[model samples]
Target: MVTAPFNWRPHSRGRIADDGHGSAVGPQQAVDVEAARAARRRLVIDRSCRVPCLVLFCSAVVWLLAGTLLAMIASFKLHEPRFLADFAPLTFGRIRPAHLNVVAYGWAFNAALASLLWIKCRLAATPLRGGALVLAGAGLWNVGVLLGTLAILTGRGHSTAWLEFPVPAAAMLYGGFALVAIAAVLSLAARRVRRLYVSQWYLLGALLWFPWCFTVAFILLMPAPVGGVTESAIGGWYTRNLIGLWFSAVGVAIIYYLLPKLTGRPLYSHQLALLGFWALAVCYPWTGMRHLIAGPLPAWAITVSIAASVMLLIPLLAVTLNFHKTIRGRYRLVGPSPTLRFIVFAAVCYLLVGGQGVLLALRSVNEVFSLTHTIIGHAHLGMYGFFTMAMFGAMYYIIPRLTGREWASVGLIRIHFWCVGLGLALMVGVLTAGGIIQGLELNRAAAPLGHYIDEHGLSEGVGAFLSQLQVRGGAVDFLDVTRGTIPWLELRTLSGMMLLAGHIAFAVLVGLNVAGHSPPRPGPMLLSAAGRGRPLE
Candidate 1:
């Protein structure tokens, strides 16, 4: 059956994902084919890993584009309410969060899962077992994502940031996962190799973390059972874990895989990798409290949380040192090979975000940083800069194996890398700068005035500046704005006529923040655009 399943390839481009004629290969050549199949199968797959990877890749790209479109709409809404005010469902409030969810859950995660499946198989040294079940699970998961995302678009979504899906959709997604878990367990147990490597540990940790995080968050925050602020606390807890337990786990897995692959040697410090893993798991749970610091939560909760957040430096330093140490003489590979380049980018981003997280946890820092775009900026650094970059590297590494061709063209890869990467870079810069100016103004208990406001407002003023900066080619200099916002608060007037920009920002932010109707007033929006509607803090 295993051998027969693979025969569907060769002449068909999409054959790996299908299964039909494979049941009829003659017995003689079949043995010869089987021998070679086993050889290639060592690379992983019963039917073929690439087939599922391709499908997943499509799903992810679509979601990302969808999310981007949503964001652009949201940006417009902020600046011109009447632009789409006629369509209540298309409001910035709705589309922004929806886009955020789609990208985070659908785009980034689906890509991660595609890569994770590849790594999981390689680490286990096993061909996939329940191909049917996995296909079903993945399909159902997509269905759930589509329905849930549409729900958000139609304004039927529950108001949870990372956990926005209503019960039925969430159940479908989780239910699909249960099948995959079953398949994974069966496949692992049946593996030809049993080295019990550390990468597998990270993958397993991620697998476990998803359900645990989702379940806990659901019980505490789902509409049918919204437990008030307690649920809110739990929901916050889920977001942190999604980073620590889910995305972080996959990130660690990528590091473990890519480090050895790029250097052409086993990991230089397996012991260090293991140490990082356990430390993260043990410490991550406590770190969520840092987000709630001075947020009407208990003092002990915030203090311990802050302590845990600060302690993350241990993993950050250890992982950074390990990655660089391994890459000491291989820096050239980063430029020559897209895979290595992305891996290097993601690793550095992880360190930057991790270190920044520790800093933000500080009482002085969080005091000024909380409830502003500064926090949002930090979140994106972790999400896009760290996690998304790793995911892209993973895709570059995995696609050829699945596509059975060298990506049709390196030009496409380069195009995507530049467009997507540059876009994100621009976004991080503008937001960071706007955040800093806003933070400073906010912390001072007042907004900035004439000259400074004109130079840095994110609405018509800042938006115009950014638009002009785009023409000037010196935009990245503004990234300091994003980072600086962490040290203070910022707010301004209330004319209520918010200036909107491109839709991309709105969708992404909304998806990121959809945890709970986003606090209605959002403790964090802005002074330049959205601020026109509400009084300043």
Candidate 2:
């Protein structure tokens, strides 16, 4: 009896020797021919999704540069408030929101859509339907992002954290997303294979969950505004679900799809994957109110959320163990394949971010860190370190297959990787350390004093001492405890610049590849001399 090759598609029926010559062929040769045909079929399906994916990717790069410029401006204002304080549009308030909107909606989600479309088509083993509408939807998404960012600068932004886009712009986003999402749904419906892969679970879940989350948040925060502190709770719910359910789900799905392929191993346990996905779907939506721990929100709501937040450790550990087992012996693949390197990096970051999120949900911890820069670091860790990096890995893997070309330069890839890695490390590190100190100072009371003089030689010992420990206490002079944060903020600014440079390099590389400057090579792109001829790990 011939043993079946691992991961063989059961629906693959058109093997090369099916034309009455199968009796003369060896079993191994027959398997090889079947594999080749399956690959060819996948290539055809992939090509059908290429144009729309490329359009979204190109538009995402443009928004990335725009967001980077805005990030730099906002970071500079943290340390040098007077740099552009005179201009309302350049103020930190407006610039910060615009930066968030562009990066979150424009760069992050657009790239994610591209990855999802390609992965869905390949897994479903069907040509992507409604390609033209997909492209049109992507164009509409860009238009919405553009208009929303401009509206934010012009002081039309809503007060909600993640749902800051105006109603009209929000409508555009919702409609466009519907069109793009329908394409993926239709492709899945038309799948040739009956057995669904693990990646499809996540891709399908996100497609269904995002519109509900987006619409509910928009209604509560905007047109049908909720009165009082309930609005705050709703906003928190929206932001957390957007990250955990939508962005995290898509990123995790890509990681799952890529890992098995790159390592040439099946996932360690189907049970663990099922556990992870179900736990995420059940637990994540309720965990959002952990952010509202001590706020005016109801006590039970906050308590339930904290419980759910801690429960997330189940899925986090499940995913961590699964990815770890898959990649344990195949570590050598990371050196040769940029895509594998990024995917592994993202997997590790996902573990770290999830753990940190649980820690932040504790009542005591939330009380201390809620008003500090620590939360800012956590956001960057999830968004850039996890989600953005996974998107990068997916693009690196898919773009070449679409364009029929290899990466332009391995050296550029290395630079881009190290630059982003070190910059994010610096950013999260400095902000976390500074935030702790800031939090400590704010919580501590003034020292006992007798006849201490103020900066102008005035004697009001208790008042002067209390003023120094205030949260925003730089009013007297630069000697206050809050002043210590300046150097750290400036370091963050420098790290932002490094990250900006890396983004520019990535965009240029993608542009060059799309313009057909890079030709296809026989094997994978390897970083080491000895690894070039080795089979893919």
Top candidate (TM-score): 2
Model 2 residue 446 lDDT score: 43
**Which sections of candidate 2 miss by over 4 Å?**
1-31, 445-481
Residues 195-271 of candidate 1 have per-residue lDDT tens digits of 55566787888888888888878866774576566766787788899888889788877876766555443355657
- For candidate 1, the lDDT comes to 0.64
lDDT of 2 by residue, 1-537 (tens): 122233442333212111111111224545577666666776687689889999998888888999999999999999999998998988899999999999999999899999999888877667899898898899888899998988999999988888889998998898889999999999888876555667889989999989998999898888889878888888889888999989999999999888877765556667788899999999999997877888888799999999999999999999899889867888887877888888988998999999999999999888878878888898988998999999889888888888888888888898888888889889989888777656655555343222234443445654675566654432332245467578889999999988998898898889999999986745566766755654452
**Candidates' RMSD to native:** 14.5, 6.5
TM-score of 1: 0.76
Report the C-alpha displacement of residue 129, candidate 1, in angstroms: 1.2
Q: Would you give me the overall lDDT of model 2?
A: 0.81
